[model samples]
Target: MVRKTLISNKAFGFLFLFIFLLLPSFISAQTQEYKDYTVEKGDTLWDISQKELNDYFLWPKIWKENPEIKNPDRIYPKQKIRIPLYLLQKEIPETKPKPELETKPEIVKEKPVEKIIEPVKKEYLVNKDILIAIGYIADSVHSVGKITDSPVDRTILGKDDYAYIKTDNPVKIGEKFYIIRSVEKVIHPESGRKLGYLIEILGIAEVVNQENDDVKTIITDSYDEIPTGSLLDNFYEIEPPLAFENPRKPDINGYIVATRQLHIINGTWDIVYIDKGKKDGLQVGDILAPTLQSKHKIINGLIQLINLRESTSTAIVRKCNNSITKGDGITSVK
Candidate 1:
């Protein structure tokens, strides 16, 4: 004979109440329906999301619901995945019977109000003017116009100097463009990837007059001596940051490929170029530190990204006990 355990009336009442409360959620889960999809050749989760969910960015949602998917990028043929229809499709409105209203006496209770403390924006070490001069590397810069010649017989141009810009594109009066020089291309030391080109900001120019294919402009702001044949593009607005924004990938790391001024040895306040850029989720106001195993650990310091491009970023050494060298690996601190 099977032995039976006796329960008290009070214990049975608690168990009944718990089961009564959880019964609705259990029933609701059973009613929830999920559409199934089979992975086919040449089909990516992103493409599948767009076809099924009507949004490409919602692929993560589909990936989350399916635990078997080992990798988001790699889904083999004949693999089955479930789509959460509640997230994919919109809800249909339903009408229900309204409850009858009953009048009741009002009662007021005094409660403590909770307060949320906001973080204050901290000013960055460098200002806009300094940032403009400390230009970052980019994959490519689309030059809209190029300086052809100047009214004065001079090799280099400066502020208040009038120059003729040649371009097939249309020009507008009072329109402004950044005067820049394409220095050279930078390559990743370890990855061997073409990071981008080094672009130096020379100055700013404003369109004054247009004659056929030539647009006459006056140099507005001169950071460095502008030269003939310098390319003109839209000006970038750089501002001093409050506190450093949290790194998109907290553990993201990259190499310090090069240093500013091509120094044989680098120290604090020196500008360094990182291989990682916007593609790697790096952004302005991000703080980076030399990895523990990186060379010159005694001189390792923190670097703050001042500017970013598609393939690279320019950072300033904000803090360090010693110094950093090219090829030293750096990781996000915040």
Candidate 2:
């Protein structure tokens, strides 16, 4: 009886030792499948997700692991990224996640990993109220010249009963002066967000002569400050969702919302300044559908039918139009 008891104790001790030695290796093997990645030029999270996980939208999952990817906008070349692929697959039901107590942990025999893919996201159109900041186009130093077209002098002359601006410098017959207004956002019908502002051409003045940087100037026309509720920018004009019937003809499509006729920059080729910006869901490389309009007879009424008037002329968004105004043209509606 003594020998039998001793034998039973020995068996129990051997079993406990075996389990203790095997537990850590099992856990370590299960969780050791994650890898790291380096971001190269033109590397995008969506592309990497597609290559690694076969789903582009799954990028947010990888982004959760790396909190440093703030402002999904600013990515540098050759940045390192962590790719987490070690989690065991639990079949998440379509409706809700399984409760922890209800699920049993299963060991993975092997870890499968995929190479990262860099995807190019197409640009998309958006319109929203955006904040506009003013900068100096040209600065004029003081010039002591005759002030013929002073606003106070014009009031004295009874030329017109209105407030006018004047300066003591050289003046010309057809010069233009600008009353600049800042930009802001409005409501969007599609996305339900307020974005972008409308830049308005306020007034025109002309230069008479130059003293130094300062010049004598006269107001040619008195224009009002762009009032509130003015039609600011047009987000929908990035691409008219229509096609042109004739490809050979030079088609006029949408209306111009804003323009920088004087300043042409890279990425602004043949592109008109728009009212819509990134706040309106606009992206950098979306293909916009150009369209046209025609009057058609519907049931018992006259309806304006917008037609897809042309082939898809893709507009690469160089910059978001932050100051779209109402009644502004998007593109030629052909």
Candidate 3:
């Protein structure tokens, strides 16, 4: 009887060890499988979420899974990240029901009602002319003159300030010119070739005197601070006709290449640079819609062409469901 009991005890111990060794493997197999992703250059949480989870708004879920990423904006390339299984599985959490609450009777009081008449507010849509008038569409191909000197010791010159300009080009006395500075280089979106320089209007000046290569001028109107080396160009005074009368969509399709402030993200009233221009048959007062590339291309915003160059144009954001960003496609619209 003692020998039989010993053998049974040894068998039970072996069974226990076998179950302990196999338990971990069973648990691991039952768990959901996660895909591993290696981060690449120019990768952002927003973009990764869009690529992995099919929703750009799910960036927070990605951030929650990677606790080591303290700053979601500063993630580096070559980092290994696990795309959570929950995101892939599309698991919906079970919601708990609210407990029933005791109700109390409320007292109602009757009062005399009066009819109120409110004035209707008129809605005004933004037009291309308005954008040009507001200095959002400053573009000039004519080379003016550069400010060489200012009357006062101040660095910035304004209206009524005397400024000496130097230009190889001839300027007629009493002729008004726009003071501008080259700010950025505009590039083609697809070919990535340099198109032209974007000039910013600094102020306005009129030629007071002409002597050799030097032209004496006085700042007449200032939009921004007029500094030395500001180039002078022919003032654009004629306003293009507004297309509100007969608006029509163009057949040409393009994409946003840049913005006025050179921002990656933009919203309503912000100026954006498009690949389409006069060469592409885009004209002033042409309206375009900014759209996202999806299974069913959705337009998120509206933009109006205000300034057209040879191969590019500047547009003002008229309306947007959300903020417009770089890489958003553009299509002409009525």
Candidate 4:
């Protein structure tokens, strides 16, 4: 009798184990799923976003989802596409008993593995006048000192009694100056003239010595404002409303890849290096159009917050960093 009773109890335990394992799966009732799509010729990103996402402006999201598309404008015929679907589920009550508290697991963030590849380097084609203007603004806003002019051409305001600002010059006395070293692409909202990213300030030099006409060394750093050539001026304001008025036009794109913060090169006042070079189809003298990252929301959807999303900053490929790798900023409108 004792043996028979023991066998029956063992059978009950097995049945309970099987039921417990299958219960959660049956209660959740989730299954894998997918949607099929047929590609049509001349289907631009704008077209697909309008059809799939219901918002024509959401083309960026579609392109981001499908990096395989390559260019936003290019698509082929009869290409098979898979649309991702995020399932909706209601939160269920916890049923499992709480176990004894244990030590937390160590959080280790794995760095992305980047392949070692040679980057293409090309000479920049910056305009001398534009660089001058950019440099002027950079100094005035970010650096300390004033740019002054004399028969000597330019000089930084100095403590020397002989030195004085030529008011006739574009840069006035007590005005600050900055050197425009390089340009990088920034993003604007595709719909309007707005910034889509943080405004970046890279390299710069200060107006130092102002008096000597024969030898003018714009102080790379100084506490006093002096009339000098190191003092540069911004011919125009670097704002979206003051700049791009149209959305359809192709904008310059890229990000600051490297910088010479030390002000080593004579011309490298606030100089910034861009990822885009000649190989990815960019010239050195190219100027960047910037856009600030914007926020978004889903008006009416079950899982809008969780499913649909917006991005802060994305690189525009004004200059190709080569190998089409990460950290290479892309093109944008100025």
lDDT of each: 0.72, 0.38, 0.68, 0.36
Tens-digit lDDT string for candidate 1 (16-88): 9999999999987776678878998767665697789775446666777887765454577898889986876
lDDT of 3: 0.68
TM-scores across all candidates?
0.54, 0.31, 0.52, 0.24
Residue 237 of model 2 has an lDDT of 16
Show model 4 residue runs off by greater than 4 Å: 1-34, 87-334
lDDT for model 1 comes to 0.72
Model 2 misplacement above 4 A: 1-5, 76-78, 86-334
Residue 282, model 1, lDDT: 73
Best by lDDT: 1
Which of 1 and 4 is the better model by TM-score? 1
Give the per-residue lDDT of model 3 (tens digit) for 162-255.
8887766677999888787777766665678775666666677888887776678888776556778777777767444433433446877888
* lDDT (tens digit, per residue) of candidate 4 on 84-193: 44311112454797798899999999998999987642211222222322221111133233334534444433333223322234343333333322232333223333
lDDT of 2 by residue, 1-334 (tens): 9999999999999999999999999998677666678887766665676667655445556766777875343456788778776422223334675566666679778777887897743321211111011111111221222223343344232112222334344345345444344433333333444333433333334455555544444434333432221221111212322221222222233332323322111111222333333344443333232222224311111111111112111132222324323333343212
Deviation in Å, model 4, residue 136 alpha carbon = 29
